[model samples]
Target: MLDGQASDLRVFALGTDRAGGMATAAQILGGAGTGPGEFQRPTALSVGRDGLVGVFESTGRVHLFGRSREGELEHRTTFQFRMDIEDGCILGHHLVVTGLHSEHSGVVHLFSTAGEWVRSFGRFYDTDNPWVSETIERSLVTCLEGSDEILVAPLFLPEARKYDVLGNLLWWTEFDGLRPIYLAETADGMVGVGTPEDGYHGTIGVTGDVDGGIAILQVGFITRERRESGSDPEISTYVLAADTGEGALLGRDFGRIRDIDGKGAVLSRGVPFPTLRVITWPPSVRQP
Candidate 1:
């Protein structure tokens, strides 16, 4: 989970039983401070296949931790930067971090897993082309395991871009009026949730009212199909679901989706008292 509270800086791991049932809290990593293992505002969390957890703090510090035999977090190493980090992710032994210097400029910094600097790219606000300017606001970065491909979606732009390990632009696609908020890789390909720039304008379910509801968004999937012979890859798009001003389902209000699993996704819903809702994919159709 993302640790935003400066008073209680930690990366918590919720436990699960052998039968996939909810268990006790497994472990907690880091504390509040500016030390090697402490945090000042851990904003992003990513777990690597090697069982290491990378925590990116708003203080421009990155900490790496591993699980001990007793299920406790053991601090490994840490790195620091100058800019305020917006988001980050781990790709194998590489760490990619996006930082914002001013209102219009940002950069993506790459580093080795051992806390050594690699290379940096993308300048802020200079949108000359795809390579030079990144314009990452609320940066969202995701790495496709074993593919050496990374996906980045900046809030200010309407497109989600793909880049290689060397920071080369691969391809990008527009999401129409939707602004991508979260991205994840699935068995089929990649799935993302985009909230409508303006509130929902379509028909309100059953009520026939035009007043836009609190929740209305789109979920899209992108599948890459390889060619039989030597040719460019073919990509297919699917609109899994797009809410048209539906109020709530199963007594739960709708919010942004956090993570997607095989059969469904985990949605962060409600306010004042935030709660989680595990919803199956291709949600049931709302009656008009």
Candidate 2:
């Protein structure tokens, strides 16, 4: 996960145990700087073929890292773009970036590890108003495992689109009344779903995620009312069924789901220096 401290910004690899727990690995990558090997406020992380690591910053710069002969990650090069990057993933020799751009043609930007722009595609929501378009178009992107397909999930919308590495559209699926806050690639090459916030539209009235599926950890509208009355919203967790998209009560108070795999999920739970938790999925919730 990307730690956004202005003083000690760095990326640490997370390792999981057999009991479904996680912690930072010994190897630390990147540092705070504007130089070739350092980055500031990194927003996304992607690992591609050939031991390539791309650290994307909020300022539209991607810092590339590769393993040295001694098997340690070393900064290789850096590249820049004019748009604000939201999220990205690495596929083979290319880096796929998604963010807000002046051009509304597509939200996805394809680039080489050498920092060359290859192409851009995938439609973004546009209402003719720049501010609204930008806010609504924010999305999280992930490259599928064992394939060249990438999945894009809008932050405030309940839909996902699949695309090939060449920027060709494959399939688009929409979930009624469910906005995706995150997306992950399964070990079997399928897409795993996550949660969302109704803070923008206030339709779903919730936020956060955990485990194998989407989870609603708080009620927004009710929470807003309670806060007005000087009370905290009662925290609870609601898990969405993978097969039917139906939600059931889980437990309480977890952070946003960063990624999910065959073992389980990684959750980001604090501010500035967030703590990540990995929890194994219950057998019933694990998608086959």
Candidate 3:
């Protein structure tokens, strides 16, 4: 889990007992300050090749940690991105982030480990209004397993796009009936922050890729009555195939899948204080 404390910013590795009970935290990276090893408002985590871990902040700061000769996690470097990053993944010596374009008309932006700006691509739509394009392109990006390809999905749209590292769009498909919006209560009242709608809306959040597909957690009303009454919507997780946007349901109300690695799918559940768990893939049951 991430420690967002202003005085003690860091990431911890949770180790579970044999019985899969409570977890113990081990400090992996970070401290407290604007210095190289410290963090500020860290938002996302990415595991790269060679046991390197990346800690990202929404403000475009990134801190990379790697093991030292003494077998301890040491802060290797820090870099700055030029976008309002939402999610990202580290590929070899570069990092790929998703959100708004730093200075162009794309959603996916790439940067080198040494802070060099790489090419940005994956333009979703075109419009003269910057607000419309930015709201519609609020996206999350993840790298496909065993390949250099990446998949990007907008938080409010039912569409997903796959692209190669060279900024080539391979395929794009829309998930039928799956327009998900993120709702939050702001000073202006309830708002769909994901798409900027003016009221309470359904939610569909993409966690990342698992088993060569996109894993998403979504909440939706099954009936108009439930929606009208403000009843809790059904929560479900699904692994949709990368190319076709078709796949099987993994489970319902099982927590938000955060990132999938070789160990499994990392999930965060509960509120106020969250608990993290890892569930194996091909999870033994597939809902129709």
TM-score for all predictions?
A: 0.60, 0.66, 0.76
lDDT (C-alpha) at residue 33 in model 2 = 80
Q: Is candidate 1 or candidate 2 better by lDDT?
A: 2
lDDT of each: 0.52, 0.61, 0.66
lDDT of 1 by residue, 49-154 (tens): 5777888877888888887798677888888866678778788889887766433234566778987777766532444332223323445665544455555655
Q: Residue by residue across 1-288, what tens digits does model 2's lDDT show?
A: 455664222445444343434454556666678877677768887776466877888789888888889877777888878889988888877788888765534778888777778888876664555555556667777765456667676656655566788887766655443323444555665545444343222122222222233423232223345445654334334445432335555654454555666567666554444566767788876755
Ranking by TM-score: 3, 2, 1
Better of 1 and 2 by TM-score: 2
Worst 10 contiguous positions by lDDT, candidate 3 = 195-204
Model 2 steric clash total: 1
**Top TM-score prediction, candidate number:** 3
Model 3 misplacement above 4 A: 5-20, 179-234, 248-250, 261-263, 280-288
Candidates 2 and 3, the one with greater TM-score? 3
